[model samples]
Target: DQLSKQQSEGDSVIKKLKEELAGEKQRTHQLEDDKMNIIKELTVQKEKLTHSEQALSDLQLTKQKLEDKVEDLVDQLSKSEKNNFDIQKENHELREHIRQNEEELSTVRSELTQSQTQGSSRNVKDDLLKERETQVQNLKQNLSEVEQLNEHLEQVAFDLRTENEELLEAYEEVRNQLEESVAGNKQISLEKTAMLEWEKAPLETELCRAEKRVLEEERKYEQTVQELSSACSPDTSALQLEQERLIQLNQEKDFEIAELKKSIEQMDTDHKRTKETLSSSLEEQKQLTQLINEKEICIVKLKEKSSELQKELDKCAQTLRKNETLRQTIEEKDRSLGSMKEENNHLQEELERLREQQSRVVPAPEPRTLDSTTELESELSQLHRIKGHLEEEIKHHQKMIEDQNQSKLQLLQSLQEQKKELDEFKYQHEQMSISHTRLFLEKDEEIKNL
Candidate 1:
């Protein structure tokens, strides 16, 4: 709209200037000739201005597209952030499971300690046996629940890994799209610039040709005026009449010359304005080219980052495999612990049965032999040793559980750190994109304003 207004005002000024010229019979003939030439020159200048305007509009459109592309990238980054958040939540849940398992392990350790302390009491053997059997059953149930939860957690982890992979692929696609758009914009601008330059060259050449023709005609008219003056003599009324007409014609030529000078001055001004516009447009083109170059570099960086992320994904996948293997080892250890508890239960039953037998039997001469008593005593001693060995195994398993828990904690921490780093990189990418867009927009507006 603004461009049209400027064009309309230029037209109105040209009309007013045209109207100001004399319409005398002596003047109209040559004035029309000059006016026609000036109109052609004006049309040529208008064409240049139109080309500049078209270029400006094209740049504005490119700016709008870049902004839209940046906005889309921002949206994708946000989605990636959301996915990371979900993964963090999943990690937190896994941590919770670790904590619960740790607590259960501690409870089991304390119960085992209490049972060991009470082992010397013979009267409570039956109670001890019953308690051990019950505890073993509870332990088995807990292990089963833990194994189920671990399977669920593994599935969740797998799902998260797949999601991360999908997001990474999506980001790569977006990056490629952005790169292609930048390339397209660069190509389009180059082509338009070439076309405008090609088009302007021909128009300028034609304008120069017209100006030269007009100059040649003006020179011919001057020569004819001089010849007509020389033809006129003071002796006859016809000659005097012819002389006066020539004088009027000369005066009209003077007027036309003055208008020509003014029009030439206007042309010079318009030419300068056109040059400035072209120079500014060139500067904008340079900036756009630089922006495209920067975008290409950024795309390269994005590709590298994607490659790094893929590596990280592979590492995570590898870690998950290790975790699965470790989980199997831990489950196997739990099973061993369950079997040990069962063996301890059996041993406690035997000890209780021996205690009951001892409490009921009398040391009669024929029924109880000395060797049998010694054998029972030796068996009792063996059971005690086995109990001690089972306790040692339980302690070793507990230590292993503690170590596994620590490893898990470390793994979780490392994952969190990696996530933070990933977030930081994404944020930096967003910031750079925004800054680049803003700078390009500022420069674009500056060029157009110029």
Candidate 2:
């Protein structure tokens, strides 16, 4: 009976050992599978880390390039500033030169006036003519200078207008880009936020499931702990292995959570950068607005100057017309003065013949009455007074004619300048038309070829 009892205990112990061995084997197999899965996941994570590192390197390179370009632009801006300074210095020198030219013009005008006054008294007609020609040449030079200054002013206005247009176009482009970037960034942010939120929702659900699984695993672990406490010493190692496996799983979960948190932090940084960029764009927009306003003011000033120039041009035209009319009147006066001189010459000859006749005649023995002698003396005084008046009138007419001739020469010079300007305008128009025609023809030919 004791041997049977011993055999029964042996059988029970052996069965218990077998069951523990089987449970240990099952646990070891499960651990092996878990290890393989962890290894695969680690490899995947490593690959992802490598790709992220490469992308970061590329982004860093791009940032470096952008910084370099910004430096180049700054250097270019400095160079442009120096060029502007040079241009300003040149403009100041040009203004000084113009002032000198004006002084020279004034001096020439005074010399011309003196020469005109002395023309009649000058014995050498040839010298007077040469002097007059020189004066005319000087006046022509002054006119050319004035015209050149006018052209320069016009060119400056054109350049300003073109620059204003270019600035407007650039401002518009920047504004459009800013608006589009804002819209695009907002859209991208919304989409990314939505995507992240959607992903987070799934992750939360999965996390809840993982927590429930963990709870179930904890229950299993507690059951194993209780079983180990109640079981033989041989079962303790299997229970310990199960506990270690659970710990490893928990550590993996924690690593995944940490990765998600890092992604969330990166998203936050991106959102902040977007906000900063938007603020910078707003500042740039404000600057562009101010620039546009300044350009508008400049354009307004240019228009006012153009109007003033037009008024001056009109006044000049009116003066020219007045000069032409005065020239005609002076010519008529010259003809009248010539007629008066001829009449005076005839009267002088008649008076000389009467004097000779009076000398040849015997003394008036018939003795003229005092009344007859008095009448003859009165007529002679009246004729002398008429002759003096005619001489004064002739002198006045000649002076007026001289003045008119000078004015006519000035008007002629102005007319020549106007004609030259007109021709230049016509030539420019023709060039523009020809270029337009060529472009159109090229387009037509291309269309035909197509």
Candidate 3:
């Protein structure tokens, strides 16, 4: 009956473990799906990031070209200003020359008039008239030169006006291009943010659902464990002690699992924050180094946790092997108990035959029969005592086997749990490294561009 009860309990435990395994598998599948979805989103983000970077490069090139154009226009404007100054100076010199010639011509005319009024000799009058005529001819030449200078200056002024108009048009076009580029950059930023938000929403919901499911499973498992502990008999105090320790370990493992989940969530948040910072304006990009440092710290922590989980897995494996050996030992002990029971049955049958033979015997052998019966009774009592001791030992061994099995199961469960956590940690670590590399490259490129 004890064996039957033990088998039933083992079956119940196995069923529970199987149920937990199925649940773990389901959660693993869910995690895989979430991972795939996240990967898809990351891929999309990468494409968009590439596109944005390309667009940014193009915009930067455009801005550079426009800047160069503006600088050239400024140089041209400075040169035009200098040329205007030189032209003005030349015009001033020309005006002064014309004025001096006019004064000379007027003086010459006065002298000629004075000579004519004084009635000087005809030679003197002729000479003065000739000089005045010469002066007038020189004046006419100067006037003609001045008129040509004026026409040249007017042409230069017209050319300057036309060039200024062209420069203004170019400047306006450049300004319009700049405005369009700024608007386009703003639009791209908005689209990027919206896309990120859209992607983040679904992941958050899935994480929430997964957490809820895990919590529900944990509660059920705890309730079942409590029921089993309460149902256990006082004779199994050792088993109970073992169970309590297993429960504590399980609780610790659960806590660790919860911590891992929180860490995963934190990692997601960090990733999102980093991405947002990347998508922010150029000024905010300067903080990327610090963020990368923080991410590195997170990676280090994750590595530590992974190492711890690995150690735990190793320990569980060792314990599982030990439990396997214990199970074999228990089975051997059970066989010994079975053989001893068979011997006891044979002894009981021999005693029964001896009794029947005595009943069939005559009065001539009564004394010998009485002595044989007494000896047989003593031997039977001794056998019964041996059988009782063997039964107790078997019961003790069975309990040990049950405890070993329970521990084995717990170890297996912990192994599975640790394996899952390790996988997730490794995956997240790879993702972080990938993102870090990409971000580092991006920052380098941005710095180079700057």
**Order of candidates by lDDT, top first?**
3, 1, 2
RMSD of 3: 67.8
Q: Write the per-residue lDDT of candidate 1 for residues 1-450, one digit (tens) a residue.
A: 644453354345435433433333334365457546645644554454345445444544544454454444445444544544554454455446545644554554445445434544333434444544554464445445544544554454455445445545554554555455445444444554454445445444544554454455446445543544454333347545644654565466566556655654554555455455445555654655565566557556655654554455455445455545654655575576557656655655665655466567645532333343344445435544544554454344444434434443443444444455445545544554554454345435433432
Most TM-score-accurate candidate: 1
Cα deviation at 323, candidate 2, in Å, is: 14
lDDT (CA) per prediction: 0.49, 0.44, 0.50
Identify the candidate with maximal lDDT: 3
| Model 3 ranges off by over 4 Å | 1-13, 16-19, 22-216, 219-256, 271-450
Number of clashes recorded per candidate: 0, 0, 0
The CA-based lDDT of model 1 is what? 0.49
TM values, all candidates:
0.49, 0.34, 0.44
Distance from true location, Cα of 79 in model 3, Å: 6.0
| Poorest lDDT segment (10 consecutive residues) of candidate 1 | 17-26
Please provide, for model 2 over 31-131, each residue's C-alpha lDDT reduced to its tens digit, 9 standing for 90 to 100: 45653653464354334434433543443354344335434433543443444344345445544654454455445444534643443212222343344
